[model samples]
Target: MGGSSDVSRRRFLQNAALSGAAAVSGVGIARRADAEGAGGGAGQAVDPRSTEASGRVMNPIVPDFAGEYGGKVPEFQVPKRPMGKTGLQVSILGMGGFHLGSAAGQKEVTEMVAKALDHGINFFDNAWEYHKGMSEEFVGTALKGKRDQAIVMTKVCTHGRKKDVAMQQLEESLKRLQTDHLDVWQVHEVIYYNDPDKIYAPDGVLEALTAAKQQGKVRFVGFTGHKNPLIHLDMLNRGFAFDTVQMPINAFDPSYRSFEREVLPVAVQKGMAVFSMKSMSGSGEPIVHGALTPTEALSYAMTVPGVSTTISGMDSMEVLDQNLMILANFKPLGEADMNALREHGKQFCDGRYELFKSSLKYDGDLGRQQHQFPTAEEVPA
Candidate 1:
């Protein structure tokens, strides 16, 4: 709240709406920190604000967690893996940027990120559109002096329109994240049938992305989509190699539009890093519906062969500890184990469980027009 005050919450939300995200209701921003995790199940209420120092937000990692987590510091030992051929090693478990933005306060989100890094988690995920860029801004705060320790990634949701507009989006993201360049910059949410084609069209966002890479504003370029595996393949078949590809690689995904079945092989053949998310069905809906336990869902995703790293949204230290524990004791599921788990999840594999694949709810550009560049007067000097 302190550092981000330069852009008021009103402005943040207003810009968010203009950028294509509708306001989120029932976010529990008013909930008290001590009241976190009160629910015993999937619908359990999450504390929107961090229990960290109230209003003392924005700074690099401090040696103390006394002001956060009710005075308990999280500790864990995690492993790192190569993210394909990027030459960057990432923690087996990466932090999700969306849920971090959902938390009420900047201090809380920053502390969660610091805690994750303190415990050996080095990969931090973000997006320009997440929480009106508050997510990237918070990561910027947490990584202020410790940026080199983390492999940071964020996305752009430009719908593959104007190359200059997409370039502006990247510049805006860089300013929000307080970084001159990103470790990886992805084209976000390519869900439609023609999404890939648009990106490859003349003066498309891909032009800006590649030019940025050449200019050192971005080290790598990739694309992310959970809606359809075909869209993922469409991206690859369109030409222009990628350094990574992010997609849903959860337990139930094998049965639905199946990014795993359709896209994983292609990504592997291309020698691109396989980044997996929505392992627990994005927002815990599948786990809440009893499709699979969190461990089972995550384990299923991790052992899916060719996954560089599996990311899960963790809003609290409790969730982070549980995931770290899973990683520490993790043993890749054997073929039989994979088969049985997939079978168990097959029942709930209907598009209902994996809603992103069948609905425009997760598509960032559904009702919004392509983001346009501002007039010359609006451009910064």
Candidate 2:
């Protein structure tokens, strides 16, 4: 009996050694744990694991923005912006997932995703049609086993007032994302005159979205528009509650076609999360006109009140790292930083709204006729 007991103890010790080695090698074991939701629920605090089973190693860097202003960095250095009136707190800098699917390969996509998560970016944005749904796939893979670590937001762009079609699209998105629910589900790519009436018609997209929320498949509902603030406002006022609104909020935007002046305040007043996009002067044109450096452009956007988050397309690891650094070190822009950026960017706004002018690059839905609103002539003038 004593000899048999000694042999069993030796066997158990050997098995334990092998298990520890496998965990250190980053084998499939840790991934399984994460997928099982072993750590915690979404947005729960994370404890960095230092074993090979941790899958990918992430470098966490909090930028020293407060240092530039002669102030001590707060213990919670990353600013949390509220998502509309919902009282959901999100990182001030959000990761734009559109380019992640469109413009990146698997390796680049995975690296970017890991880096963003490491850098405290909780808000992630994606669209169903982006990269033919490759974006969602990449995100799903990168976030595998780590779904509870961040807030995932995605959009759908199906046509018509067909509830079934909308529901199908939503399911497709969920499958692609490998998630049971989304933090925010947005009506993607809204443009001129399509009004809430058409979108929220009898069997409309809103019905599907509301149903999803009720089912715990989505937490919040919102909309995004790159054109016509009036359309955005109309959609908001159309009766259904929206938790968030995304629009073009940039320095050049204020000079012409000012969503900042007209629409942003409305969103803030309505207590909806205000997401800002087109901060790079829409289509990356501002860089050519010497308007602002990429860092300066992001900084300017960060300073805006009611601007919950600024989403930027990060296709490359370098771009991802650069953005992470900027956001990590993000200090609220003072008068000097703000004034200099505005002055430097003034000359670029010479009646050339490239995004609106060149319909080919920006307006992919123009040919569909689904987005068209009634012209003044058709409206019985």
Candidate 3:
């Protein structure tokens, strides 16, 4: 098990003290059973992708939380939507696993998991390379006993055409997540031009994924790429059945490479559930740069037609609360409003905004020490 550094340990103790006070003040946290159905009964390990399985009732948001938005606030439960033709019904707002591990400590992450389940958000996203596996480790710890309350998805970063290398990564991910099987396992960051050919090659990662599926280690398969919609389409074009497809869904997507325009329809045609990420322009910098308010950016992603869930990395309680607030009051933008937002987005859609596409910063590098992919003998025939 990965141990926290000295600084992290101190932070954990401090945060734990604060949490105890918060609990005493009546913050309205439901216990495991009432809030999340932790073990048996409502929380019994049903399909992680389905919300109806929990059978929890959504209470309406009290008027005090309405804030500046006047009039009746919508009911408060996180909404669930169908994921393509897959029998999974995912929560519209998913917890980004990368950020979960970035929390101050294990206690904080555990609290976030509990709170997210309490708020009805069930989809969680992670990747093997995130924080060098620390992220998955923390997620595993946080979800120690409440595994059934959330749909956990993680990715293997190797771009290898080798099944053994990919399978090794999958096994490592499973161990770190402390789960026997994953709800979803994805091909992470398919940004390079030849990624699709490599993935579809003989003895490729796809073969490994099929083998894992046959072994019941994974329930669903999908891929995520933000650099280009063409790459996303290429993966789809290869004719493999994908249960989910994740990409950037935001105010500016329609103006740039436009995953919404070039790829979303194709995924829909293939009956793949759409997962949205980078709504706040990946780093939340665009909001600071005045592109759009945080609420507007998030709402923009949530309203895109056919999106099953939009994931934002939440490392703090304040951010989680703010996002939940946005979801609680969300109303899809009308066509005219969407058009206007797109026009506003046009000014900022230049490649500079989406660095993951224009640069290699976000690419998953397994490092030189690891087995380099496409080894001479492993190359596609």
Best by lDDT: 3
Kindly give the stretch of ten consecutive residues in candidate 3 with the minimal lDDT sum: 30-39
Instruction: Residues 65-144, candidate 3: write the lDDT tens digits.
Output: 21323322234688888977878888888987766665678888888888888878898898887777888898998888
TM-score (all chains, Cα) for each model: 0.77, 0.74, 0.77
List of clashing residue pairs for candidate 3: 37-43
The clash numbers for all candidates, in the given order, read: 1, 8, 1
Clashing pairs in 1: 48-104
Candidate 1, residues 151-259, lDDT tens digits: the string is 8899876776679888898999899888899999998877667777788999988888889999999999898877777778878987887999898887678878888
TM-score of 2: 0.74
lDDT of 1: 0.65
The positional error of residue 204 in candidate 3, measured at the CA in angstroms, is 1.1
Name every residue pair that clashes in candidate 2: 26-52, 63-328, 63-329, 84-271, 84-272, 84-273, 85-271, 101-135
Runs off by more than 4 Å, candidate 1: 1-75, 365-368, 371-381
